[model samples]
Target: MILFGRLRMLLLRTIAYLVDSFILFILVIAGFQCFLLILGLHPFIGRHLYSITGNELHLWLFFSVTIPVYMYYVTMFNTRAQATLGMRAVRLQIQTPGRMGLGKAMLRASVMLIPWEATHVAMCYPKPIWIDNQLQSPLFYTALGLTALYWLLPLLNLNEKSAHDWITGTNVIQWQVPTSKKP
Candidate 1:
């Protein structure tokens, strides 16, 4: 099987992330449209998405969709197909030394969510809807700061492994597929 070099791996992974992010963006929009429409609050969300951001129901819906949506794409896809749609398109697969189990696949996916969740929280820190007080604690900033390191983890290694990889003992690699070429 052909293995992807560092540059190739990083490029494919970045493309996969962009594709997957677009997919999530579409899903979030559709979900919000349907949910608000059902609640008959469509008028409230007529032009501004910000209208719903502070709504408790909207927050609930967002979290509900966010966790399962991401976990499904990351964990279920990795567990079942060994790759997500974007990763499949790029011919990248998640590999482990032994038979990859559901738990480990799930852990790998969850670990990858650290930066995403942290960034979300950091952005919302000023908003008092989630809590009465602004979340400006040192611990909060520290967690967000760690995400910076998490993102840079891949740069430190030649194999292009990330913090999530080191945490879960999983590797993202190129998957070999037969290509047809006519002579």
Candidate 2:
């Protein structure tokens, strides 16, 4: 029974994180593209900017967006004791074993923001020459597969050892607000 409860919590947390990430990703991409347009770097389709510039500008954009997003995710998870927008909606929070702290949150964010994930995204360029042949399609696929597996790790908490929980030494538990007594 305890194990099942933990598993349910983990699944909920994962779902919340995914939902938040998807929304944030879309928003960030759109915002960045808009910024580019304002600066006269517009590409016809949002996803084709890299192809148009031999991936030079694409790399710049990825780094620019990733750093701040990572900082925000880690800081919030560590200090405010919540996942980003998505996690909060589902009432899930990332916390350390005793109390959440900045160190743990930063660690979690660092691992989550592995460079390979960003590099794989850069691999989607239609022109093969844009990226090194050594890191072409196969590397991209592997990184993407790993990312999917990471997200799915929450489902493996049948015994209460979820991936995110393990990574951050934390657990996602159901939240219940305490009632206040009226004076």
TM-score of model number 2: 0.68
lDDT of 1 by residue, 65-181 (tens): 557666666565456557777788888887777667777777777777766765555544444234434456554676678877866666668767888788877778888565899
Q: In lDDT terms, which candidate is top? A: 1
lDDT of residue 47 for candidate 1: 51
Alpha carbon lDDT of each predicted model: 0.67, 0.63
* lDDT over C-alpha atoms for residue 34 of model 2: 74
Off by over 4 Å in 1: 1-4, 38-62, 128-147, 178-183
Superposed by TM-score, candidate 1 places the C-alpha of residue 43 at a distance from the truth, in angstroms, of: 13
lDDT of 2 by residue, 29-127 (tens): 677657877887754446763345535554655566676577667767865545566777887665445667777778777776664444536464444
Each candidate's root-mean-square deviation in Å? 5.7, 4.6
Worst lDDT run of 10 residues, candidate 1, spans: 49-58
TM-score versus the correct structure, for each prediction: 0.69, 0.68
